[model samples]
Target chain A: EAGVAQSPRYKIIEKRQSVAFWCNPISGHATLYWYQQILGQGPKLLIQFQNNGVVDDSQLPKDRFSAERLKGVDSTLKIQPAKLEDSAVYLCASSRSGLGDSPLHFGNGTRLTVT
Target chain B: GESVGLHLPTLSVQEGDNSIINCAYSNSASDYFIWYKQESGKGPQFIIDIRSNMDKRQGQRVTVLLNKTVKHLSLQIAATQPGDSAVYFCAEKSRDSNYQLIWGAGTKLIIKP
Candidate 1:
C-alpha cells in the first residue's frame, strides 16, 4: 500500500515571501491533517479536514495560514508573508477514522526554511 | 491547557539492551495514546498505541504501558537496535477537541554500538 505523498521535500524562502506546500494522502483515507513541527518540538496541528470539509482549524493562523482539501484526496497548505518563525517541518497525515479507529500515516514532510 | 511531555529529552542506551521512554499527560479525559518514532529528517511513524482501558499493549518488540490514574505512558523497546535511534513522541487524543491528538516535545533516543 502506498503511504501519504508530499511535494517539495525541502523549501527555502525569505521573510515576507509566500510559500505553499502540497500533500496527497493515502487512498481511501477520509481524515487529512496538516501539522507544523518546529525544531526540537513536537508537531502542532494547523488544520484538519474530513472528506473535503474542515473538521478543525482552531489552531490555524487565520491571518496568513490557510489550507484546503478540495477533492478529499489531496490538500494544500499555504503561508503568505512568511516570517522567521514559520521555519519548520510541514507534515501531512491521514487516517481512516476520526481518532482511535486507526493509526495516522504521515509523509516525510516538507522542511521549510525562512530566512 | 492539556499537554503531553516527556520526562527526559534524551536517552542513551547500548545496542542489544532494553530501552524505556516515559511521558506524562495532563488530560484526564484522554482515552487514546500513541507512540511515534521520527528520524532526523522524517515525520513521525506510528510505533504502537494503547487505549485508556488497557494497561499494556505489545507489538513485535515494542510495548506500551498506560497508567490512567497517574496519567503516565511508557514505551519499551526490547533488544534495541541502531535502527531504533530516533526521536520518540507520545500523543494523546483530546476528548474536547474532536479527537485531535496532542503531542509531546519528544525524546531523542541514541543507540550506542
Candidate 2:
C-alpha cells in the first residue's frame, strides 16, 4: 500500500509570511495526526483527528496555526505570519483503528524554513 | 534528519554484532510500547511493539523487552547490518490519554563495517 503522501517536500519562506501543507493519509485510516519536529527533538503532537472531528489540539498554536481534516481523508496544516521558531518539519501520520496500540503510518514530512 | 544542536546520542556497533538500544519511558501507566526506526529524510517506520502484559516480543532480527517495574524498554538487534543504521525511538501509550503515544528523543545507530 502507498504510504501517506505529502506535497512540496521543502519550502522556504520569509518571516511573517503564510504557508500551507497538504497531506493524504492511507486509505481506510480513521485517525490522522499532525506533528511538529524541531531538530534534535522528538515529534510534538500538534493535533489529532478521528475521522473528520478533532480529538486533540491542546498543543496547537491557535494564534498562528490551524489545521483541518475534511471529508475524513485529506488534511491541511496552515501557518500564518510564520515565525523563525515555526521552521521545522511538519509530519502527518495515520492509524487504522485510532485506538489501542495500533501502529502509526507516517509521511516523509514537509520541511519548512522561515527566514 | 538535520540537527541544529550537538549531535544526537549515537551507538556504534560492528557489523554482524548484536546491538542493544535502551530507552526509559516517563509514564508508569503506559501499557503499550512501540519501537520505531527512521532513516535520514524519511519518516519513522515501525520496528516492533510490546504490551505491558508481556515482557518480551520478537520480530525478524529485532526483539523488544519491556520492564514495567522500571518503566524501561530495550530493542535488541541480532547480527546488526549496515542497513540497520538509523535513529531509533521508543514510544508509549496509556489509557489515561486514550492511548496517545508519548515519544522519547531518539538514539542514532551507526554500523561499522
Candidate 3:
C-alpha cells in the first residue's frame, strides 16, 4: 500500500511572504491531519479533517494559518505573511477512521524555512 | 494544562544492549497510548501501542508498558541496533479532548557500536 504523500520536500520563503503546502493521504483513509514540528520539538497539531469537514482546529493561528480538505482526499495548508517563528516542518497524516484505535500514517513532511 | 513529558532528553546505549525510554502523562483519563520513532528528515512511524486495560504489549523487538496508577508509559527495545537510533515519542489519546493524541517532547536514543 502506498503511504501518505506530501509535496515540495523543502521550501524557503521570506518573512511576511506567503507559502502553501500540499498533502495527499493514503487511499481509503477517512481522517487527515496537519501538524507543525519545530526543530528539536514534537509535532503540534494545527488542524484535523474528517472527510472534508474540520474536526478540530483550535490550535491553528486564525490570523495567519489556514487549511482545507475539499472533497476529503487531499489537503492544503497555507500560511500568509509568514513569520520567522513559522519555520518548521509541516507534516500530514492519515488514518483509516477518526474513531477507535486506528494508528496514524505520516508523510515525510515539508520543511519550510522562512528567512 | 495536561501534558506528556519524557524523563530524559537523550539516552546513549551500546549496541546489542537493551534500551528503555520512559514518559509521564498528567491526564489520568487517557486510555490509549502509542510509541513512534522519528529519524532525521522523516516523519514519526508507529512502533507499538497499548491500551490502558493492557499493561503490556509486544511488537517484534519492542515492548510497551503502561502504569495507570503512576501515569507512566515505557518503551523497551531489546538487543538494540544502530538502526534503532532515533527520537522516540509517546502520545496519549485523551478522553476529555475528543480523543486527540497529546504528544511528548521525545527522547533521542543514540546507539553506539
The candidate scoring highest on DockQ is: 1
Give the per-residue lDDT of model 3 (tens digit) for B29-94.
888899999999999999998888899999999999999999999999999999999999999886
- Model 1 stretches astray by more than 4 angstroms: none
User: Which of the two, 2 or 3, has more TM-score?
Assistant: 3
Which window of 10 residues has the lowest lDDT sum in candidate 3 chain B? B92-101
Residues A2-115 of candidate 1: C-alpha lDDT, one tens digit per residue: 999998999999999999999999899999999999989988889989899998899999899999998888999999989999999999999997766467889999999999
Candidate 1 CAPRI level: medium
Better of 1 and 2 by lDDT: 1
List TM-score per model, in order: 0.97, 0.94, 0.98
Per-model DockQ: 0.74, 0.68, 0.73
Residue A96 displacement (Å), model 2 = 1.1
Clashing pairs in 1: none
Question: Which pairs of residues have clashing backbones in candidate 2?
Answer: none
lDDT of 3: 0.94
User: Which tens-of-lDDT digit does each residue in A2-80 have in candidate 3?
Assistant: 9999998999999999999999999999999999999888899999999999999999998999999999899999999
**Which tens-of-lDDT digit does each residue in B1-113 have in candidate 1?**
88999999999999999999999999998889999999989989999988888999999999999998899999999999999999999998866757888899999999999
